[model samples]
Target: MKDVSGLLERTAQSQGAQPRCPLTGTLMTRGLTVPMDWRRPVTSRERQIWWNADHSFGQIHPRPALDEIPEFYDFPTYYTHDDPNSLDSAEEERRIGALGRLLGSIAYRFERGAEPTVEWWGSVIPRGARNGLEIGCGNGDRMKTFGAHVEATVGIEPDQRAAAVAREKGLEVHAGTAEDLPPAIRARKYDAIVFSHVLEHTMDPILALQNARDLLTDTGILSVEVPNNASTGSRWMGERWRWLDTPRHLNFFTPDSLRACAQSAGLTVRAVLFRGYVRQFMPDWILDEARITAAQQRRAVTQADIDRQVRHSARLLAATAMAAPEKKYDSVRLICTR
Candidate 1:
């Protein structure tokens, strides 16, 4: 196999130019197009195709229902779950969570100058506060942080297995898609709703947001995080940028696209800010391709490659942060209100 590190460097180095908005003809704020190479085009045959072709593994885009949304026909998957970049199994996923907590702790100490509260699950808890809903509450990491303050904390997840794990961890999780939210959840109201890296997967993102809105109590807050379409990493990394897990992520959003969708869903884009995370996994992205290409076939990435990717990503992320203005590049965390 090829040297994973070298491949990663090339992958990250390849697409150096920035991308522009397909709709507006202006430079996209993040490289939203990088995931396209992994995605298949949308068609009536997609559902059938999904079932036939590695449905358990690869990302698959469903044709957008014609009545509500236009057929975006072209977009990319945001992440992959199998051969190319499979993380450890469910039993081992805890280490990834541990890494997340460690990162959050570091950021809180150095940047926030205060202990970061796990308030996402409790952001709306009423002690005269509001209730909160967490969408795609993977493993309850954010929810665990929120357990203290909210009057109510609920999470909606589509994966049954993941939901079971979250429940075991003491989080109130519902096993259902954003489109098919349990009716019990749909009937309640919340004070805050969160969509963290979860919106890109839905076929009808606007409708999903609208559904979230419907569950909110009066004067609710909606918070979200999405990979920035114009970031330098994406512009340079192209298809190998980890965020572009194609087929699974059907839509890409710029600030303009986001605002448009939020407005249509009866939500107002109140605040949008760029946030940075360690670019550690990036080197692995390139290395995976090189390993497969060199082997002349599909295969799994090695642990050594993953370790190197993390180290490289960390240094790059720090360098990018120090070198760029906060506004000039980064993924976005948008805060909205209704």
Candidate 2:
């Protein structure tokens, strides 16, 4: 509701080493310094995290240059960047592991929410819509899963390798970030835009939302999901939180901060929803992330070790299973309109 034009003018400061809070227009202070990357153990550069005290908004300190950003996602092990179709049954089993392959159905049912990942966006997509767009569509799995609800869907990805993989499946995927829309995509307004897990990675999330507004039809829907800094898992795990996913994630948001961000982008905030599994509900999830960090402290965990972890996870079911997560959930979803 307040004037954000002056705020936008100041975002030029982002070009410097420090970044201003996109929602409040305040310069952020230091939060903590991340030493090792759990997922990418080879990474040794220690990066600092900065945050705004009042609002739960944060950014990676000593900002990475735009050119250097692409290299961060170049690794082959990043799951989201992997090509799903390329995984043969053997490879899939290897990735999921022996215990997972054995108890696959049971574990999946017990852990997966009633709603599929695509349902989060599909449930809100306007009925009778003809076209939609997804930023950071990954391997196009989300699009293929939810495309039936809409006539057609396209995607934009910053990773050229991941974008090419999606394109191979006869999808309309353009390789680029939302901050810079290719001329081919900038030409048309989309009926709906799904910006899941992509905003925080952008150099400027507020600017990205504003650009999405320009691409959206007046009646279009924009659904966004980001890691919730206030989530219980985030608190329990601290720097070890799986979602923290530093280096790859350039920004962090809490419930209030996310709402203000949408409103700040000259858009109307329709609803705010918090949803995701926590360690209380999924004990194995923590062990899974712990293994990544633990591998560094000692030898790599073997299949036998994973099997023991799976058994331990099953034992934790009764004591851990109480109620679903509410405010303590892992993600914050914002439904908005132009």
Candidate 3:
């Protein structure tokens, strides 16, 4: 683990030339750059710059690399959101639900892996939606919910704990990395490949999405949801960006970069929507930022903390209504057809 972390540090030091925009194939630059800080007030200048700019506003180019392709092969050590002792089981459940809702706030009609609602997808899926694959079906709950709708549904989960949870939910899950997709999943191609917040964690987005395309039947749609690097939440939090889970999250994406990745992978993006909204907990993020900077303040992500996050998020909802909408505040969704 130390070696992996060391390698990651070295990778972070190596910055490549600025990336090119997929839309115009031109170089992209940040219009508004905010230095890393906790209490810095969110600026209107930053928001407008993000809105009108062709490229993302504050994304740190050339993300750090990992020792292995499956970035999560070794879970991250930072304890921002994973604390067993912080709260009792009941409180933990509440936090998980809150986080889920925070994530759910995003406007995605098709619950990434939850496929039992074929009628939901059937309505959108032009008739003859044959086969589909879900790369990281966490807990399989979503797959179990929506698996029945798809002609065939298969899930890949590298974590043993998550895989067990998925199996318990009556899902056909494989405990392995997408880099080593099960033979069965690879053999069968589908009309669509769904990746929900899974691509950002991969070491190589191009290879991962290309693998997805290989498994798709011609003209298949690749549905993905990733943290918007261009989002206000991201700019508010730089290196300590909650979504930029060092070592765990190896790749970051914005509407532009995502399009770049998809085009490089030979896929055409049909639509990109940034509707997910979460006002976010300012104090908690401040605390987390302090912890990251000062080792003494660092602690595991606990249930009690999550509880507060839920309550804070609720307040944020009302606040968003009263104030400007952080349209680029939450995770973004992209629907692409190969």
Best by TM-score: 2
* lDDT (tens digit, per residue) of candidate 2 on 1-338: 12234433444466566666666777888786666666566764666788897877788866676677777877776776663443355654565465555443443444433233566556777878888899888877778876877888889988888777788889999876777777777777878888878888877777778878888888888888888887655664566567877788888888877777788888799877765643333434534555644554545756565556556445444332343433345787888999
Give TM-scores for every candidate, taking all chains together and pairing residue i with residue i. Answer: 0.60, 0.78, 0.62
Q: Which ten residues in a row have the lowest lDDT in candidate 2?
A: 1-10
Model 2 TM: 0.78
lDDT: which is higher, 1 or 2? 2
Per-residue alpha-carbon lDDT of candidate 1 for residues 1-338, written as tens digits (9 for 90 to 100): 11123323432432345432222334333322222322332232222112111111111323333332222322222221112234434432343334432443443322311112564334433355456788877666676665466666889877555566678888788866565577767767877777877887665566677778777666777777666655666545545555654544555555556666677778878776655443323233434433322222223446554444445444445555444433234356667776
Question: Which regions of candidate 3 deviate over 4 angstroms?
Answer: 1-85, 88-120, 279-327
The sequence of per-residue lDDT tens digits that candidate 3 reaches over residues 140-204 is 65555445556777888766666776677677888655555767777787776678778876645
- Ten residues in a row with the worst lDDT in model 1? 48-57
Candidate 3 — worst ten consecutive residues by lDDT sum?
A: 43-52
